[model samples]
Target: MLPNIEIIVGTYEEFLLGYQLKQQSEEDGDQVVLKQTFADKSHAGSLKCVAVQGPWIASGGSDDRIFVYDMRTRKQSQILLSHSGTINSLVFSPDLTHLLSGSADGHMIATRVGSWKTEGDWQKAHAGAAVTHVSCHPSSKLALSLGGDQVLHTWNLVKGRVAYKTNLKSKSTLGSAPDCLCWSPDGEHFTLSGPLVVEIWEIKKAGVARREKTPAKPICVAWLNGRVCLAGLENGSIVWISLDAPEDEAAKNISAHEVRIKAMSYFDGTLVTASSAGELKIWSCDIEKQELEHLTSTNIGCRPTCMALLDLSSFKSECPQTSKVVAPKHTNQEKSNVVAAPKPRGVVTIEFEQDENPTIEDDDNSTTSDDTDSAKKSKTNHKKLKQDEESVGQSDDDDCEKSDDSIADFSDSESFGTDGFSNDSDSNQRPAQRKRRNPTPVGAKKAKPKQAKKE
Candidate 1:
């Protein structure tokens, strides 16, 4: 099973876009929290996009400017004026040294992290409509961008050149723009969500290898444990898919919210999904075994526009003499990664074999203590095995009807809700007063940090 989860909510008064941060956390699973609000100036347009580096939070608004804030000091550090249209998305390099900003003007700019100054660094990244989303490759020197032209473009970041470009044929049917793109952890596939359906594309040689559709219109996609793909659906449900399993493995759906799912992120084994209703639901997954368990669900009171995970180890190492003592070794392992059962190859086929009924027992009792432990483990495994059998049985029936449907079958009819802010907080309103609440420094929080609670 995946690890447990702790949730932090960024209760924003307005629709937020591009609000993501990279920081060190103090709490175990809930290390990162929305400690403060900076630059409430609504005039910068609708704070449409945000990106986080170690200590800096970079955000863009309708004002066609990029603003960088220092989280530690709780102050606006820098602002850059460049885009002619509203900024929609911002992405930071894996190393957090470079920033990429996408705007409605059909252009993208790459700037140094600390200083938003762009001299010879800016590149005309896209040609059609607006650049909707930008993603940096996990292990390669490449990056990908989705454009309003219904095309996916790949870039060679080091050479600053286009490597490949492919139009999303499924998107053409919707006659709308692509809004978001998510790359799988292994960089072998990616998902595009917008205007009804979530399309999964396998990275092929200069083209798409294969594509699959889901039931709900997807707004965000995240890789939970390098195996399963978690899709935040517009219908307030979170769908979990085991990529290793066949296309019809009965997508696991959890009713996570009452409104549209706006953003999602996964760390260790915990899945954090935010909705337009201002609720954040955390789900746990067993990636290898293709099982999902609902964990704690908390209402953050205000809509969460964006979310990100911050590793606590990075914070503790920064200070050694804090009064807050770190947890024991067991706690460290629990916080390090998502726990998933080892995936059984071809779950559908395995179910058939087990259902046929064949049982055998060994006649050895000399190793009594070890044998008892083995028996308990076997019992837990058997329960999970039975569940998979049922899932496969149900999926077989569902697949028959869906086979004739086109690739667009996954799209759903759902409209984006009105912006979460009140009528008084329209686009014309100037940015409002900023409220700052600095979190306790890394070493001054709780003691014997709680273990990430498993589902």
Candidate 2:
């Protein structure tokens, strides 16, 4: 199922490309796509982010503009311009009716699909800082924005107001402002990462559900499942944490790249990660085992800034069928006789009639003499056990009562031990009495006695 996907990669060199992979044979691995689509200088910028849905792909970068392209036409259809600063992030709504963009100018604008008009007033999302990343909730009705001012803002698209805002600075230490944000598939929780900590939060709560210290600087983060999160570190490692475990325990770390990880995405059961060293790796995620199996790696010869997975199921309806490759025609073919199974006889019928009333039968009411005798013996044994337990309990209670009644008489009659002192009174005071007795110094003379004075 994953092999049918098409990958679109945006690069720091201002290049936007598409790739289609296929398996030529069972023994060999997948064949990488050599043909790619390139953009001209009219749409040039260091592509910072990209988003794909159905047959549409949107990219933004240093140009302060977004280029929306159609895969079926292989051309750019529209260019949106509303940002005063560089576009840092781009995301399409879950239903693909609106495109949301975050810019370094602290503004978030949503535009409709075909109209190319702004839907509502552009939000001044972060007052004094750039919006680093933004993600749409699964309902497509809310958007989450992470900003450099150390705040997370959740916007209500329908009402055109800020639904909730959370400050992500750590209370104990001050350097853990969030740099990236990812919403879970179920939309009940989200994750934030920066500096040394990764925190998971419930959508409705004001406090974090769990916070964990990472081994390296987490640059990007993604959710692998409901309970597990994958963090891409600056040192080319991916740390996997199980939120169900204690916060202080060690997380499983996998060495993924030789340099800082630039981007990562998980679709269906496959994971794709890229590094600054120009290496792209595909991994198969085992959800049940909580493990990653390395599938293949490709040297793209260029650093990738962002990546997106495109499902081409909708493209089949728009494109011509001849665009697909076909096997060569065989010249000399031999024909062979084939047999076909016979058809079944026409509509065999059966009939059934219902009875008004049915008689019931039960055999458990009768028992043999031996069974009755054994049952009686079992009842007697149970009764005996109950009596023995109750008698033992009553005897223990009586012994405790007797001890309580004799306490005063026992204390009045002073009893001495082998040391010739009452055990009850002296036992509590021996340690204090030992400290009061003075012992002379090892090498000092004894003190002289004092004489009485006359009036």
Candidate 3:
């Protein structure tokens, strides 16, 4: 069973600053809910990046510190003064043994979990510009860094060497910046989005395989269900691309919000997207048709800059067994329903095998296009998972029926203010309303359909 969507809104006093949300529940088709909230106690900064590792939720702040908190206990766990400038990105290794962080000062640091000591540090990872993002390969041995230089640099952790580098070929005279990057689950390809286009590059070859320009600048992106990709636009919309389709096929656009989308992520088959206007929305993906349909929308009182998914399967396993309690005959249905509380879904485990040679192949013709195309087509033909809509709808209705419950209310809090921080009194206030805008029309020419051929 997938967890319900979780939303976290950040604030200072009464002004909203940022928000983070995750979509985990697929059976109920309900929108993401408010899971947690973080406010800058001193009104000094906002959250920039977030990483979920086991039971810990780590957040990078503009204050130049990485704050780790326990989700279940809702308490601050630890803080690392690891960066000299604003932290731009944070990622957990595949094994969740170490945390990697990049900052605006052009530094990247790997911190060991148990000792909280620096395992390795690189000061000039991106020259003078800030490292925009850092992603560990699914296998964990390689890491990819993207920055203002418009280049993707791959690093070999075991060998301590620069593995490979690639630059995007942009049509814009002003040049293009790689705003977001994501590797497919299988690690055969990676995609980059910037300016007005999202380009998918094949790792086996050194050239661009497919490109689709959107109407607005893309701020964030992620791969969903192996064969489709989701690009979140700065205009508060999302574009869904079918990688298995022809290159010229048009992407399906989903209307999510009216605020600029700053962060997004996918867990299981659910899509969670956040924006600057303090709105967190969740959607369910149709893997076969490559479509994303809206499920729920919640308002967190602050703008959200980053987000992640937490696996809570371990907690369920540790739950204490309860002895049966007598119930009145008239309440038998209620007692039975309570007894049927679903078991938590099993833990999500991803194993990483280090690649000795992390280098990108130099030969463009190393792999035949026919072979690549066939592989992609076969991957896309996977059977679609049948959704239990009736069960899901009933569960959602039951949740709604308990509207008086304190947990169901998801609105903006009064604690957020423009000062970039909040106080204890504000923390108890109701959340504020989210600002919304109509999505920009999908632009022509630049937003043209993608072609089928693999380049």
Which candidate leads in TM-score?
2
Give one digit per residue, the lDDT tens place, for model 1 in 13-130: 5433222222344556543333233324434344666666566666676778777765555456787777788787887787776788788887787887765676323345666578
Per-model TM-score versus the true fold: 0.58, 0.66, 0.62
For model 3, the stretches where C-alpha displacement exceeds 4 angstroms are: 1-44, 72-74, 168-174, 314-455
Provide the clash count, candidate 3: 34
Report the C-alpha lDDT of model 3 over 1-455, residue by residue, as the tens digit. Answer: 34543444333232222234444657867544444444545215776777776766677778898887665665666889978998888888877778889899988899987577898888888776788889888788888898777667899977766698766445352146666777788777778775788887777786567788798888888788566788889888888876688876787787777977877878778777778886777777778876776766766665566766666553333335689999657576776677556899764333323453223233344444445556556655642322456666666666544433333233334555654345556566554433222245578345679889988
Stretches of candidate 2 exceeding 4 Å from the true structure = 26-42, 170-177, 314-317, 321-455
RMSD of every candidate to native, in Å, equals 47.9, 34.5, 49.0
Candidate 2 on 11-78: residue-level lDDT in tens?
A: 88888767655454445655433234354334467889999877788999898989988877667889
Instruction: Arrange candidates by lDDT, descending.
Output: 2, 3, 1
Better of 1 and 2 by TM-score: 2
User: Residue 254 of model 2: what lDDT?
Assistant: 87
| Cα shift from native, residue 267, model 2 (Å) | 0.7
